[model samples]
Target: MSSERKKPDIQYVNTDTKELVNLLIQGYESIANKRLYPADPLRLFILWVADIMVQQRVLIDYSAKQNIPRFAEGKYLDNLVEFLNNTIKRLPPQAATTRIRYTLSTKRETATVIPKGSRSTVDGKIFFETTKDLVIPIGETAGDIEAVCTVVGEIGNGFLPGQISKIVDFVPYLEKIENLTATAGGADTESDDSLYSRYREALSTYSTAGPEGAYRFYAKTANASIADVKTVSPTPGVAEIRVLMKDGRLPEEETIKAIEKLLSAEDIRPLTDKVVVKAADKVGYKIDISYYGFKHGQLSAEGIEKAAKFAVEKYKAWQSEKMGRDINPSKLNQMLMEEGIKRVEIRQPQFKEVSDTAVAIAESANLINGGVEDE
Candidate 1:
């Protein structure tokens, strides 16, 4: 039932991309009569070769020249980073946010209006600022407001929006500020290498039917971030959209409403269908793993535990309410052993069939070292 609607990781692709310097050096070495070395003549020849390549503009269909081969001004080396980032998804940085609750100060009877762009900081490392002005009328000064990141990055994530314990940013002029929900969507910009590895991902996206495809609309239009989505039709004309939020955390009310609005839009959702948006129902299961090789030094016990954790994480992402999707311990065992894990046995979670409406969630997996029995 979990359908993805986001950009998939780019696939690995090696193109016949060439560098001017490398090509020039190779050509010089190939010429037996030429002894190219660090000299004015050598420099000139290298510059000429680089200029020729630059003028030729011989690059992959998608490749762009970043630096021109010129010693003047500075060594303009190729900066593929910008080209790579723009070529595919913009690879946007996270938008920081916090839900604020403001109240009219009893001391001042007059309504206090704090203009938009009011700033707040957390330990000087990160800052959250009000997106719009906070207006507390003559009779009322207490209310909730939203503060978004002044900049983009992961530094602004993880705190609850409704955290009342601390008020990091506020002036004496404004009413007391209180947080209402934890900030969850603040994510670091994806790494260049990761984006580079997914070069093919930028070339083509899954059809709107792909798991990532279902999430694209909300991500694009609603500005909502979701972890997993299951698109299903329990019956005809009824589209059951269940989403698993990031890190198993529930989304903000505003986020959920925005998703509903977008999914129910005539252009995005099926015109003939009735859409119901709900959080994915998680089914937790504990896996007891027993294997003989960990103690014998096949891999460190901690390493095996790490492998188990990674496997569980992957499984969680893949689980859904799709028809005929069920937990198979043997498959899990096989996946683990592929990383040098041998003699595996899954003692818990006897396999069973799950219907299309039920999502299988692996809450935890217990690793038993050297086949130790758990009481």
Candidate 2:
């Protein structure tokens, strides 16, 4: 269930709120680009929700007097909910997933199972617990039983409405500050007086204080990161490195040609899954989390070597491809994005054509045009 209600038109929102939303959208675009995924929809969904949960959790922990652990062992789902509520304090479920059917049957009279803190155990009755305590009728169908068990107990009690709302509100503020900072820069070189210096100072103050003062302070200097230089990281056994510039700022022809030259000669295996990119507003640094799946490994040197080897081969190939010895970045980028990653960060890369630069160059063309847009 999404809490994404259609908000009123921009005219209805005050200037500040509207500004914040734009900034947030940009941040989302930046983050979505660096993350890579395995070709698993369910896993992708999980990662998406997890990222949101982690983002909110970290924000709350950073702001609060007493920090909370973002990850809870043995109760990932439960802890996720709790963290959301306690940190964000929002009403309704922040995220939800539905399973239409289970591979394992619930109607069996007897089945072997593993019990918590012990090995296999046998029990006459199958019992389950929920947040709320409720009575289960005997001889009830599994579907009916599930309905009866809608006990709203403390499963994710820690996630409350108020906390979540606050966290949700905080993101826009961070974005607003960035936008404001960009507005401050002047055209003249002498006027270029350190956007970086002012940005750091504003960020430090924002960290200690709230978004109120910083929003006004940084608004004038806010500019986006432009694609200038692209960094490709390949550790052994990992996936190849490829990114695309969606914003029109980059010269598509030359960039594509450079990337294509690399991919042709490289030993890099084509990556089918997509990548996810995230940007930190204050630091202006991008963090990309790419996914590569390998067979389960044993706790042995051989297992470690296998993983390492895979990463090395893949990375070297990607590097070679990136170098124009194997494939072009544009083609590799297109293939990877098509496979599902569909998201990438242009990472304020240097445009040899325009010589213009910013923290990031994002494409809004997809936003109004519909269809999945590159983030």
lDDT of 1 at 309: 64
Q: 78, model 2: CA deviation in Å?
A: 22
Which parts of model 1 have CA positions greater than 4 angstroms off? 1-91, 104-107, 121-124, 153-157, 173-175, 184-227, 233-238, 245-251, 266-274, 294-325, 352-359, 371-375
Q: Residues 1-375, candidate 2: write the lDDT tens digits.
A: 111212332221233433444454455557775433465464455556556655665555444412222222223323443454332111221111011111122334433222221111012121122122222223322221111112222221122112211111121111110000011101111111122223223442323212323321222222211111232324532322223221212222222333334332223223432221112111121212232222332324343334433432343233222111221234333443343333333322122221112223222111111123323
Provide the overall lDDT of each model, using Cα atoms, as 2-decimal numbers. Answer: 0.56, 0.26
How high is the lDDT of residue 130 in model 1?
Answer: 78
Q: Candidate 1 — what's its lDDT?
A: 0.56
What is the per-residue lDDT of model 1 for residues 31-133, given as tens digits with 9 covering 90 to 100?
Answer: 8556567675885778776776564554421233223111101111213334443434424566757777766557466767766876665556566777888
Q: What is the C-alpha RMSD of each candidate to the true structure, in Å?
A: 9.6, 30.3
